[model samples]
Target: MNFIKVYTLTALFSAFTLIQATHANAITAPPLETQVKQVAQWFTGLFDNSQQVATNPSIPLITLSSCSVALTNTNPVTGTENIYLEQKSINRFRLYSFSQENSAVNLSIRAFDTNYSVTGLCNRPESEHTLDSSKVLATSCNLQLLWEPTDYIGNNSPNGCPTSSGGKVISSVTVSENGIDSLDKIFGANGNLLFATPIEFRRVDSIPEPSFTLGILAIGFWGTSKTILRKHKQKSTVSEESLFNCD
Candidate 1:
């Protein structure tokens, strides 16, 4: 009996330890690429800054031209797929290029200004639907951007990007399905805050095509009419049965 008890106790302890280890792993497991993909969807739409700029005078009056997230074939050498974040403005354009590396994401940002005809080149053919190197006059910065939860936070690489604006910039952006909030700061060479902007952008709703909207309305009306007819048929059947029973 004592040997039996000892064996059972050992089995229970082993099971308990296994369970604890599995629970710990589940809690501490690194985020998957799918999670990042879902988060990217939140940023994949056109956002307008007009209302935000109007409400907050401190923020810059720059407009947000577009924000998009898509899968691209960028690195032919490695043959690895990557998620691309393209953000464009009136005067500046930025691309956050990222790929899943093991359990984490490796991200980098490339910035361009109006001097480089980025917008035009992006529309041109044979550019792989990417930036055209021939038209690019100069690249402003190439820095590593870090990802956390729903945010991408990073600063300019060490003396990597010298902006014509005369300061190093640090960017912190919080993104969601509804809108985006950004706190962008530029510090002078002396480490003093030269400029700061807190901007909010709201997502623009895509208007459905008139034909699609009409089709949906027609389907709804048809379903409603069918339901009404069904009820009317049931009522008529019940009245007919009553008359027959009275006879």
Candidate 2:
């Protein structure tokens, strides 16, 4: 009877211990946010293809200035979209008014030769007619230039347009006075831009590890308690049986 009680207690204790351990581990688990950021920084540095994957701009003695991508598309055949950019005192460019004839087919495209230069655009030179198609549809599309918002606004004012600093033009792009849907279609169809380009950034928040650790600990405690209770029951049963047999 004692042996039976001991074995039962041992099994109960082990199960309790296992449960407790699992709970503790869960509570201690790391949050996904920190992990993601760490991974992003590491990978961004590794590829860093910003410089290597450049194309040449048209116009003599001109080079295309590298601009940060506000938006991009892996596929762009479904709708037109706008890419917005600001060049400090020069111009707030909007690559707007893109659209496609057909929304059903997937667009595939290659890089064209008529790359743009920052200064060349300021000069208002005619768009170069490249041997390459001006834009293509496909796996991804890049933004080289965009429409000028400040110019659009100033051109509309009852009051005169704002003067820019250092003789450079400064303009702002407003939420289109036209509804977003109409604007989207205009931008999309105007030249086959991406369908939806919202002017906001999506920030993912990080979670701390301590909370996870605590949760794990709680699970472990519950498991251990159950195990202890089971062992106690088995011991009581064995004791009762032994006394009955002795009598």
- Displacement of the residue 75 alpha carbon in candidate 1, Å: 4.2
The lDDT values for all models are 0.40, 0.22
**Per-residue lDDT of 1-247 in model 2, one digit per residue for the tens?**
9999999999999999999988976665333333222221211100111121132111111111211111223433233322212222212222222232221111111221224333333233223211111332222321111122211111111221111111111111221111111011111112332122111111112221222111100000000122323443443221110100000
Local distance difference test, candidate 2 = 0.22
Please report the candidate that would top TM-score against the real structure. 1
TM-score per prediction, in order, is: 0.50, 0.20
User: lDDT of model 1 at residue 104?
Assistant: 49
**How well is each residue in 1-247 modelled by candidate 1, as lDDT tens digits?**
9999999999999999999988976675346554344444454445566686566554434333233322233333231122222333323344444445555434444433346544533233433444443333234333233455445443343443343335455544555555666654545556766434456666665422223111100000000122323443443221111100000
Q: How far in Å is the alpha carbon of 26 misplaced in model 1?
A: 4.4
Model 1, TM vs. native: 0.50
Worst 10 residues of 1 by lDDT: 215-224
Task: Pick the lDDT winner.
Answer: 1
